[model samples]
Target: MSEPKSLEGVFHLVHMIKRHMHEQIEQLDLNISPMHMRVLKIINKQQTCTAVDIAQLLNRDKAQVTRLLNELIKQTLIEKVPNPEDKRSQRLLVTSEGMEVLAHLTTIDGNMNNKMMKGISREELKEFERITGLMTENLARAD
Candidate 1:
């Protein structure tokens, strides 16, 4: 294949994986996109993150992140509070409902991983992860 075609294949592979991940995640009735879940996961880890923080973590735009946060707040999956240091900004956190959804999604992820690794050895899986991480880092640097 041509170099451009090869790159397209890699991009499509990432897209397919993302689509499958979201499809499985939706089975848990989270009603959130992969992007939304990513934001939630980051906020959950940080405890209280701002839209700018989420946008930076997700490599998204600040305005789009703000819109996503607003939707999550309206859905009651996340709550917004005034930032102690920046009154103009809001801090984000997953609600109890969000936690419940995350718990289910985690279980689904565990099952999916098990299925994907049915025949792969632990060493192979580790190598795969290592290579993918390296490739991701390389691509990030190219940008």
Candidate 2:
């Protein structure tokens, strides 16, 4: 029989995409990791949320999100405001600096996508998104 093909290539692709994006950010001398960017994006989307909410939204552990949020705060990318309803949990506030950097990263993200998928058509992109979503669901089920 011929060599068997596997979905391992998809895993490799995911790893490389992450590595490449990190390199791209490093080139910009931002000193922020991809996960840092992810956390910022999450906070920006939610506007005023807690670390717990962020962890739940990203499906990450609270400890991990707390660490990331700490770094973001140190970088002045996010601020913690008192949660009126719950004094125990503070709400995250995205700073203007954070929004500015996120906007820049968004541009980098778009350029990366365009460069990586130069020839892919709209239909192909849509199909890829659908398949990837299904794959994510399948992985979650397996877990």
RMSD after CA superposition, every candidate: 2.4, 2.4
Residue 13 displacement in candidate 1 (angstroms)? 3.7
lDDT of 2 by residue, 78-128 (tens): 999999989899999899989888987998899788887989999998998
Report residue 44 deviation for candidate 1 (angstroms). Answer: 0.7
Clashing pairs in 2: none
Model 1 residue pairs with clashes: none
TM-score of each: 0.83, 0.89
Give a tens-digit lDDT track for model 1, residues 14-84: 78778878878777666888777777788889966888888888898978988999888888989988899
Whole-model lDDT, model 1: 0.83
Q: What is the lDDT of candidate 2?
A: 0.86
List runs of model 2 lying over 4 Å from the truth: 1-6
